[model samples]
Target: MHASSRHGTVAAAAPARGGRGGRDRRPKRADAPDWAKPPARGKQRDFKNEQRAAGGAEKTRQDTPRATTSRSERGVRASEVLRAVAPRTSAKAFEDVSRGTTVLFDDPREVTLEEQLHYEREGHVCIRRAVEGVEMIPMVKAVTGEIIARRLEAYRHRVSVLCPDARTTELKDVEECKRALKKHSQEDVGFLQTFNLHRNESSPAREYIMSKQFAKIAAELMGCERARIYQSCVFVKEPGMAETNWHSDLNMVPLDTNDFVTLWIPLRSLDEDDAALHFANRSHRDFALPYWRTIEGMSDLEGRYEIDTYDELDLGDLTAHHGWALHWSPPQPKDSVPRYALSVCYFADGARRLETEELRRTPHAEDEWSYETWLRDLQPGAVAKHFELPIVWP
Candidate 1:
């Protein structure tokens, strides 16, 4: 889902291949699948034209009186609005958190029925002050320093830029690379991405990800007896970093269950304009919606869903979302400070591997890494219980 060009341009979907009425059979791009490759420059222009035409139709629909008045005419409550948009079982899980039914992770084992319902219904929940902002400062600084060092090394060596799992463009020289990095930092082209910090037991990020405090909450939210660490990454969104398109983590994962969760921990306070993550409330239940297999597809889905975002997210406040939830973030304001966030993904203890061709052909670099590093050796249909997937919850 993070597929993009070396310059960080979002890849557009290729036209359906084969013949009209036949199955799509677009040719795959070299080194990646069709879904991962940026559209040909010529195709991009055509796509934009198509989008503009469709936008006119969409505006007309929104202007219709029926569309503007439907929800208001029914006097729908906040909870009812969610129910109307979500599946029956999912809608029923919403609880009145303001009525003191919200459960903060004071005791992870003490997850209330209301808390569990909230997670099930909304596909996410926020824990205010889950960790002190001061506690994350050192970790953020350490990761940022590492990214710069790595970039410098790649530039000096005249080698390809190294991302978490793939090589990007080759740098001309130190100065050129610096200029490029600076330009990209301002254009939302690239961000500092480092993955699996928990591999180093001494890493501050590892300490946070493996901490019982976080794992217990993840386990409780997942409604699992225990949880395993699936992956961990530090995403440093430099001011003006590009928007992350809408997509579900589940589609990228090779697991066959909905018992996965991601903890998004911001290293600093963020106002709405600073590029906070947003969700399509209860959209996790809309599994039938096509997986955002391409950037174009994700953009299309964005036009179809109502996005929910927090206007002001404070430091230490953490968001936990189900793996299947649809979420995205806009580019940070150019004048804002850089955004550093740590994310840890967890899966229920008993999840099993999904043996499907689609999983095998997932075009994203991260998905490829997940398959090769975490699941390649496991037999299809077997429990996803590799040692790499360490159990963090009891």
Candidate 2:
């Protein structure tokens, strides 16, 4: 069930008032995200059936990755790699692309037959706490504002300080910067994304994105030996950012393979009303939509496919869906703090560019960043092996 189908959100101080947890979105720092603070001592909100199984404990049989049991001893848990990789400023993600110098364990891991079948039938699957090190995600909640401040500061430094242009606005602080970015990107209608933070090498996200843990999960789900990273993006949906219209990620990219998968990792516990992800079950199998529907606005495919989503995604829980699967999310009510999620896309190592006639004519100018950064100089049907795209698995 999606958020609208659920009756409650995270507990707050306003059960009696009955309006968005009765939150007052003012006084700057006082409006701390609830997930960052310890849960108040009181009656635990009736979560009904949803599980908060942290550190990979308390999982049902269906939720367990059957392939990881015996192999679990050999395969490195996600946390191990994160702790091993010290944050360094010089190295970028997958820096040792062909050289086999990565610190992570390189053993093959598999998904249970049931899980694979579920993904085949539904086009998406949720794996709870499989990426165990995501327990560190709560820290991301604290630094959400800092990320905004730092990024805008860098932008101001580049344009206003260095170039001395009248074009740039005198963005005062993080709040003003946030408003400017929201207006710049139509954050209510679209999304705010920062990609490849791992390129900085000093970012903690670098370990998570470059680690073989995510690559192995992608490979196992797609039944492939190798999964090459196409990109990693951290998506921020702030309070008051409206719901996003339904669209497919595959529609925006130039890749031409059915083996592509995107893993969505929540950096904190998500509330039912606050940006809960919704997917069109099995929508990828019948991909007749030939153009980028995002540019065209809300798609009308909801009538054709069933919407599937969890009421909530706890910290460490993640969802991996096929690139062609249609998905979107609801608005974050003004009561909530901004929610941050990391989405990493991986495809089979030998996947190539579009070869079909209709696909060849698709206008990809809107996504020129991806083209210049990784897809440049490639003809149709050529293997997508740009230096930026690295093979993260066997």
lDDT of each: 0.54, 0.54
Residue range 1-394, candidate 2, lDDT tens digits: 2222122232221111111211221112222355543233232232222235332333342242211011112222222222232333332333435411233334423566766876788788776545343334533643354356456553433233223222446776556655554455322223455656655556655665676766777889988987788777777776666555555677656677788889987777664555667776667887454433222212334444556665555665578899888777756555566677878888888888664342522332223334445443455567776667777785
Per-model TM against the reference: 0.63, 0.64
Q: How accurate locally is residue 231 in candidate 2, as Cα lDDT from 0 to 100?
A: 78
Report residue 158 deviation for candidate 1 (angstroms): 16
Clashing pairs in 2: none
Clashes of 1: 2
CA error at residue 156 for candidate 2, angstroms = 9.6
Compared with the true structure, model 1 gives a TM-score of 0.63
Candidate 1 least-lDDT 10 residues: 15-24
Predict model 1's lDDT versus the native. 0.54
lDDT by residue for model 1 (1-394), tens = 2223211222132211000110121122123233222233432223235447887764563343211111112232222211122212211222312111111234433445665676688676666556554444555556555545555553422222222222334554557655554544222243555667676665544555676667777888987887888887766666555666455677667777879999887766554455566666567887566443322233344345444444445555677889988776656545556676778899887888765533422333334444455454455567776656778776
Between which residue pairs do clashes occur in model 1? 188-241, 188-242
